[model samples]
Target chain A: MFHLIKKDLIIQKHLLLLYLIMLTIFIYFQNSSVFIIVLISAIMTLNSFYYDDFFNAHKLMNALPFTRKELVSAKFIGIIVFTSATMIVFMIVSSILNGGIVLLAWQWIVFSLALAMFYGALYIPLIYKLANQNLISIFLFIYVVTAILIPSILDYINEYFPNIILFFYHLPDSQLYSLLLLISVIFYLLSWRLSIKIYEEKEL
Target chain B: MSNILEVDGLRKVYAKSQFVLKDIDFSIPYGSIVGFIGENGAGKTTTMGAILGTLKKDRGAITIFGKKVDVTKPKIREDIGVVFDDMNFSSHLNVDQLAKVMKNIYQQWDNDKYNHYIQLFSLPKKQKIAGFSRGMSMKLSIAVALSHGAKLLILDEATAGLDPVARDDILEVFIDFVKDKDHAIFLSSHITSDIEKIADELIFIKNGEIILKVNKDELLHNYAIVQCRSDTFHEINEDDVLAYITKDEMLNVLVSNKHGLPRGCQISDFTIDDITLLLMKGENNERTHS
Candidate 1:
């Protein structure tokens, strides 16, 4: 399974390089906002996996003797591995450009986690039902809509209950980090399970 | 010989009026290479997909080696290998990368055999699959299928577009596959001459229905085209005839038993193609009459 994941990553190395260059260029001129780069990086990383299967990679996955569960597991694991790598690179670049140990905001953390969770959730069903043929248009539509709606919703919430923002802002750094981490872990696991179930019923 | 694979009451009804396959039943022995012959829309590919559990069936049962198939269980797939006409390999991966990926997929994968077939087929190991020609891609697929020690192989139009040489090379590989008495193959193709060269049994399907299934030797000895006037052809009993095609003056009847043909009828050898065409026509005639 690890080898399968490694092989998949190797196949998409060029895409990764292109994404890194594009993100680096997008961040260079703008004021160093770690949140923006990290958010975009995470979304791009996750979307790469989605696009591959959405386009033409499905038959390759199916023709292998692997179970749908193994394929699903490998994909989920690949996303995690890819996302962690992308996050590390993003942090390194942001710190170099900002000239300090600039940390990610809790909002940034929450936003990234939610995006990843939602990506996996929506991608699983769409892929199972539509295959990869319509992956781009649907993924773009969802990504744009979510990108627009999420920040607006967060802003509205901040306005309605200023204390809610203060509470998250003032919570002990370690406790807040742990809570977000726990939620992220739970969402990832749930996404993995849901993807497996949907893939099992998908016609080849 | 015991049946190595059995499919009973197999049916797949798609949306609209499409019946991709309906009531398909057949069995093959442990070592037989059975040729599944049909036209473009005759559901040959669909049946193979159903047997492999890749396509959904409305209702049916498929068993291999006397064991029931559980589609959710990947272990059932370990015993079989499939090669489709279209390339299923991801274009980005090189042959070496693909081999490593496949090693983890099939527990019975033989690296030595895989490499041997790759070399034998003369496929470039370092090139991406997308860069290869159609014939090369098919050769790679055949290599992957054979690399795993699968007892049964299912090929869908595996020889459709190849030049004669490439097709012959594939045929040679298939001949070697069934050399061991424990192996069997379900080869679906429109190329009847290729089928004639390699298959031990022939299954003729037309318009989503199986019209005939018989051993190659029996089919060869029994099937004959009886040519006579269209009016005289009606004198033969419908029960004895498998299929009949009518031209302006000649009525070519495909009979299961040549011995039962009328004495005045002229008999000629029937190739697999002839049999398939006659059956297809007969099926349309049956629909027209009904």
Candidate 2:
């Protein structure tokens, strides 16, 4: 299972420098480190999925000794791995550029994890289902829309839907975050199980 | 002789299409190469997919290494190497990187052995697999299959698109693979000549059904195509006629027992290709011999 997780890193070894460069650009523009964290995690996660789709690596891996459950588990866990690793990289890069450890609040880290979990949970099963339909391109397309349109949608919500934001603000911060984390965990686990079922039923 | 792989009553039905694997059955004995021959869309790939567990068998029992196989299990798959036509490792990685990926997935991956095959095939270590030509890609795929300490190699059209020289070299590797009594090969290809060259046994599949399985040498020596007229054809035992095609005044008959034919029948020297064409194009009398 470690090997399967490492597989995503191995395939994307050549792209690491480019990903770092993108990170550096985001930092240069002084984008919120939270935005950079979520975006990088999404990119890293989607980058692996993109390569899998490009080479039909799921079929290749299935043909190998790896099981469908292992494959799906690796992707879900790999997101955590890559996201954590990126956070570490972000810290190192920030310190190298600023001559000190410039860290985001602990809340950003938790939010990044929750957001990435949500993204992976939603996409992994869709990727499996789309693999059957051979509509994998839509995955990247959706990624583009989410990357470009999601922030705008959030911005729109903040500007036009103040009462919704006020309702969340009035709620106990601890309880709201705890509830969000619980929902994300349940949804992530459910997606993992769904992906395995879809993959098992698939005729690769 | 003990068999390395045995597939019985294996069937796959595509709900979106009418194609069905009609209780297909065959086996690859240890120390021998079994060639699966069929035309395109004749369920060759589908049958292979089913055996390898890529395609789910609707109804069947597959035994590999004397145990019921769940190809999903990593332990059994560790002993079985697979090579599928136009399907392989990620094209993005170089040959050297590919070895690293395999080493992690397979417990018994041999670096020295992989290097040996790379050297044997003259594959560049630093070059990415995406740059490989059809022959080079095929050689690379075979090299990977052989390097992983596999006891049974199942290949689907492993040498389909290569030049004659490339095909011969690959065929030589296959012949050498089964040198150990513990090793076996079950390769599917439409190229009958390749089968004729290296196969110890042949299993022909048509429209998802296995039509014939015979010893290669026995097929060459005993199977005969006889051209006889209506009177002589009537005299030829119906049991002897494996398949027949009518051409004008002559009944081109393929028979398993060449000596059993009547005197008026004219015997023709035939190749495995001829037998395959006759069997595929003509009517099958029985499953012949398994």
Candidate 3:
């Protein structure tokens, strides 16, 4: 499983570099905060789910002595690695830019945990069902539409229900972040288990 | 020696209205090269996939090394080496990296054997698999498959795109693999000639069903093409014959038994390809309700 993950990273090293360079350029030009930069890197880094075996490397993985369970586990663990590494890289770059880690220590913890859970919740089952190709297309389409609709929906709710917004805003940021992180983790585990079940019965 | 691999009543059906495999059954004795011959979409890969536990079977059972194989069980893959037409290695990793990776995956992986086959096959050790030619990649695959000391080699169209020389080299390697009677090979190919030169048993598949399982020597000796005038073709009954096609004045018949040729019929030996064509014809006619 370690070998499988390592191989994936090796294959996608170029893509990783491209993503980092693009984000660095965006950050340099836009004067984006470290949080925003981390968010972008988190999104881009999740593309590893779609691109690592973009050329059908699973064919080779299936041929190996490892069972399908191990292979699927490797893929899930690879996501974890990607998310963690992206966060580390994000922190290093952020620190370099601000001459210090501008992200509050607690915020960094919550953000990293949220990012991992968020991507895992969405990407795992998608890859398990349709694999990289169809999942990538569907994810992109949903992400784009949802990106637009989410803000407008939030603005609408804030405008129409000021009392509810005020009540939620009064909660400590730490508590709110933790709540979201808990929800995300639950979603992530659910997706992971669902993926495992689906992949177990899948025909290679 | 006992049969190395036995499949009984194997069947697979996809959701999209067709059975990919229907009641497939065959057994390969240890060291025998069983040639799996079929048309392009004739369930060869599906059957192999089931045996490897990569695909679920609708109904069937497989036994390897005299133990009932549980498809979901671990380590069944340890004794088998599989090669598919499509290359699966990461493009960025060169041969050295692949070697390290495979070494960890296959418990019995022999570096000496891998290096030996690499040199014998003239594979570049430093080059990335992405840069490999089709033949070179296949050679590399064969090397990896062989390195792990697999008792059974299951190949799915691995020789499809190779030039004659490369094909011959691979054939020779297969011959070497079966030199020890403990080893067995189940090789799937549309190319009949490759099977003719090497296979001990030939299994014919058509439209997702097993048409015939034949011993290679017996198949070659017992079957023949009999040509007769169209007028006399009616004298031959269906039971004694396998299949035949009539063209104008000539009736070309493929018979199962060469000893019982129809009166005034001229008999000639049939190649493996000819037998497969006749089987296809028989299957097609059966399917059409003719």
Model 3, B1-290: lDDT tens per residue?
38999999999998785666888888999989999988888899889888887778889899988888774565767888889887556666677777886877777889999999999888888888789887788888888889898999999887877888888988999999989899999999888899998999988888887767778887778767788996666676666566677767886777667786668899866788987787786422332110
Q: What DockQ does each candidate score versus the true complex, computed on alpha carbons?
A: 0.42, 0.66, 0.42
Better of 2 and 3 by lDDT: 2
Assess candidate 2 and give its lDDT: 0.83
Alpha carbon lDDT of each predicted model: 0.74, 0.83, 0.75
Q: Tens-digit lDDT track for model 3 on A76-106? A: 6765676566656666776777688744466
TM-score of chain B of each: 0.93, 0.96, 0.93
Docking quality category of candidate 3 according to DockQ thresholds? acceptable
Among the numbered candidates, top TM-score falls to 2
Which window of ten consecutive residues has the lowest lDDT sum in model 1 chain B? B281-290
CA shift of B92, model 3, Å: 3.3
Off by over 4 Å in 3: A19-48, A51-53, A93-104, A132-134, A137-169, A172-174, B229-240, B260-263, B282-290
What ranges in model 1 sit over 4 Å off? A1-4, A19-60, A89-115, A132-134, A137-156, A160-163, A174-194, B283-290
Clashing pairs in 2: none
